[model samples]
Target: MPRHQLRLDASSPTIIVPITARDVTELDQSAAASAAAPAGAAAEWRVDLFTPFTDGGGGDPAQAVAALERLAGLLPNTPILATFRTTAEGGSAEIAADSYAALIDALAASGLAAAVDVEYRHPQADRAIAAAHRHGVPVVASNHDFDATPPTEEIVARLEAMETAGADVAKIAVMPRSAADVVTLLDATERRYRQARIPLITMSMGALGAVTRIGGGAFGSAATFATVGAASAPGQLPADGVRAALDLLHRGR
Candidate 1:
């Protein structure tokens, strides 16, 4: 397989386009469309959106691996960040904590994805982080607050917690209720960025927070999500537009 790692320290933030296909056929189509993303952009496989995983509780680990292989074949040049978000975190699927950790362990060991996202608050989060590290795969430990943005101190604490858990990257996304909320999220991001040992990904979701998706790098966000065909989250802009904005905002920095 081709080797491509997602980097957050680039002059411009890494533009990650979500691939939200539900099946192999749809995955093929989505993978093709993702090629239209900016030249250096990466693809995030929203594995929870895949029907096989959503059919019952959690899908077969073998099936998930097979699907990942197919995606890797389809987009050899694009780095893939595998994310099997659960319903509790505004995702489509629901899985037991043990099952969730096992899936992450399997995915990390498979070496198909450039990085794997593990929810920070999951009961077995530490287990998943350790397993992923044993395989030399970076883990993007993440937390999402779809309700509202937390206080700046709380946001920074969560990021620090992820780092302490041995994650290679720390990510958090929060829904902003007002313009001030967006600023709060940004301030937290910059604060964590200044002290963080690993890369950080932070965003304030929704229309009021859309600016973060385009120019969050200025405030220390290492990466931002964008849409290729279907959006996996609120306020995700078109990948091409996000890429251009990131370049413009971070130019000459």
Candidate 2:
């Protein structure tokens, strides 16, 4: 059978669990465990197989490829996302744009992941996105603002840029210091939901803005990143907690 093509929709929230287990067997078990759980609030439970954002890349490309090959065999039907976030963008690792693009291209061709994430403003985002497209893998054009939320209009423009660059998903993560700032993030996501060309995955990081992580799905965001054992981003709730929250909200509670 052909591989399962990943698709996230606006019907309910797609809760993504970032897998951080260093042990390969542990990672496969996490994926299997989530898949075995009964579906309720979350539209889907997808896996984001990636390193925590602080090391840039602790290992070489060959090691990464080896890991991907393992994941493919372990979770053949599950949707996996391959992401390499840079330290400059609130992640811990950094790689040259050319090499990053090359790595993404290779991963897409490997068929281990259904989608690859590219920092939207990276110098070689276009190259990486194009390469993913050529391999029939979707690209999530992502941007991060760890310090503060940009103006709502500016956020809209950023999403538009991602759409123009051929992203299948336009994602933005921002930090909010106050209730007002979280409101701003939601407003931007709502506006883009109507106008943007593709689905959105936006969130406000940190405790002050944590509500936005769960609430964004109600407003317009299509996906939320949740943690299993470790969190890849701030304000990430555990996957089970996220599903529960989505259930409550979806019921108008």
Candidate 3:
């Protein structure tokens, strides 16, 4: 498998494209087009093997891994981040904690993906991190609050928790009820970014929070999620749109 470690820093924030695959062939075509594009973006395939957010219905662990392997064959040069978001976390499917850990372990071992996005609430979060490290793949500890944005301190606390668990990157997504909420989320991201050793993928969701999606890097966010074909979250701009926004924002900085 190819190596896929994200290069994020204080100066340069990257764009991430989320791919919600309906089928292997669809994923391959979308990924192939993205691979041929000039945009500097990473691909995140949502492997909802048992999740409710899957395009058609639930799938087994083997199906998820098989799909990933197929995609790897098509995009040898593209870095893929495997994610299995659960229903409770605004995803469509659910897998027991043990099963989740086992699936992540398998993905890490396969080397089909550069990183695995394991939920922060995963029962064996620490174990998952260790397993990914053993396989030389990164763990992205992620949390999402679709209802409201938490205080900056609470957000930082969560990011720190991921770092302590040995995650290479931390991701937090929150919903903003107002413009002020967006500021709170960004402030929290910037604060955590300054203190944490790991890179942060933080964003406030929805139209109210769209500005942060474009200019989040200015406040210490390491990457922004955009859509290549289908969007996984609210207010996610197209990859080119995101790239253009980032370029426009940075030129002024």
- The model with the greatest lDDT is 1
Q: What is the C-alpha lDDT of each candidate?
A: 0.89, 0.74, 0.80
lDDT of 3 by residue, 1-253 (tens): 3366667764567887877766656776777766754356788888773233254434566777777888877777767889888887888677777777877888888888889988887777877777777888888899999999998899989999988888889999999998889999999988888888888889999988988888888888888888767789999887787787778778755
Candidate 1 residues 15-82, lDDT tens each? Answer: 88999999999999999999888898899998898988889856887888899999999998889999
Q: How many backbone overlaps does candidate 2 show?
A: 6
How well does candidate 1 match the true structure in TM-score terms?
0.97
Every candidate's CA RMSD: 1.4, 3.5, 2.4
**TM-score of every candidate relative to the true structure:** 0.97, 0.87, 0.91
Q: List the residue pairs that clash in candidate 1.
A: none
- 60 Cα displacement, candidate 2 (Å): 3.6
Task: Flag clash pairs in model 3.
Answer: 51-92, 51-93, 52-92, 52-93, 53-92
Give the Cα-based TM-score of candidate 3 against the true structure.
0.91
State candidate 2's TM-score.
0.87
Kindly report which residue stretches of model 2 are placed more than 4 angstroms away from their true locations once superposed.
22-59, 251-253
